[model samples]
Target: MPLYQLNETFWFPPVTESLEDGLLAIGGDLQIPRLLNAYKNGIFPWYEGNTPLWWCPDPRFILFPDELKISKSMRSVFRKNIFDFSINNAFESVIQYCKITKRNGQDGTWITDSMQQAYIQLYREGWAHSAEAWQNEQLVGGLYGVKMGNVFFGESMFSLMSNTSKFAFISLVQQLKEEGIVLIDCQVYTEHLESLGARFISRNAFIELLSTNI
Candidate 1:
């Protein structure tokens, strides 16, 4: 499939046009309206160097709040109060940490400075949120994402301590569930998230859920 190139207008090609790797389009600015529209349509942006790449995969991975799993070890951590949890307590810090914290295979971060500022704007306007974990009055781990209607599009997470990011994720899910968020869009998959109950659903089903929820 041919990849689409976005222009100045705030629009995206039909998600069905995405390449096999789920890449849908490229070259769009991460403005608030454009970014929110992307998420509402089950699309998200990833960066390579300075280019913006948008994607929507065939089998979407997501977490249903009720399906969340907490292993015995993490449960013990919660009981021991190893980390303190808070919402929106440090949005910029969370994303900043995620940007700097190195992942195993990746040499650099997709969360560029522009992307960081864009989401920070989303957060200021109340569409984006963060969940943080702290220890000894210092930030240790956290995650950030955009939420609209009954769904949350999880962006990225970071941990300075063992399983701290997982703890933050679990903590955030519980809060979202209470507030009526039914779906948590992991967007892509990782074994860490799979263990926490993120599973794949068809693209058609994923779009259907987004339409229903948002």
Candidate 2:
């Protein structure tokens, strides 16, 4: 299917219209309403340029709070208590570092200036949140995402030291589970995340899960 071009209209075409590679549409603005609407309907924007590109990939990657895995080594880290984790404590630092930090096999970053600004706006509105890791009062690693009802749509995460991002993520998951969050939208699969119990489900199943959670 040809990619849909979004304009001033706030509505999105159904996620089923996406192309084989999951490039659903292009030419949308990253306004807060559009972002929220997109996520609410299992869509999200991912761009490598000035124009926003929306996507809703098949076989959605996700994690159930109850299924989180703590490997032997990860369990060891938890027992060691080497890092301190906090929520919403250093969101700006976390996001800024994420914007500048390098990732394997990737050039530059997808967390553009506008994207950062947009998420910050969402944070201010209490729709976005961050989980931070600290060592000796210095921020070392963190992650940020949008929270919609009982589901958390993870965006980006960065680590400055080994296992710190995992520490922050584990902490966030445990907290969310305590508060009755049932699903975490991991978006896509990565080996690292898979080890922590994130797996893919069919698009139809994912949509049903989102609807039921909300």
Model 1 lDDT per residue over 36-155, tens place: 889999999999999999999989999999999999999999999989999999999998999999999999999999999999999999999999999997899999999999999999
TM-score to true structure, per model: 0.99, 0.98
Model 1 stretches astray by more than 4 angstroms = none
Clashing pairs in model 2? none
**What is the per-residue lDDT of model 2 for residues 46-132, given as tens digits with 9 covering 90 to 100?**
877787888899989999999999899888988998999999997878889989999998988888899999999999899889999
CA RMSD of each candidate after superposition: 0.7, 0.8
Highest lDDT among the candidates is held by which one? 1
User: Lowest summed-lDDT stretch of 10 residues in model 2?
Assistant: 44-53
* Cα lDDT over the full model 2: 0.91
Identify the runs in model 2 with alpha carbons over 4 angstroms from their true place. none
User: lDDT of candidate 1?
Assistant: 0.95
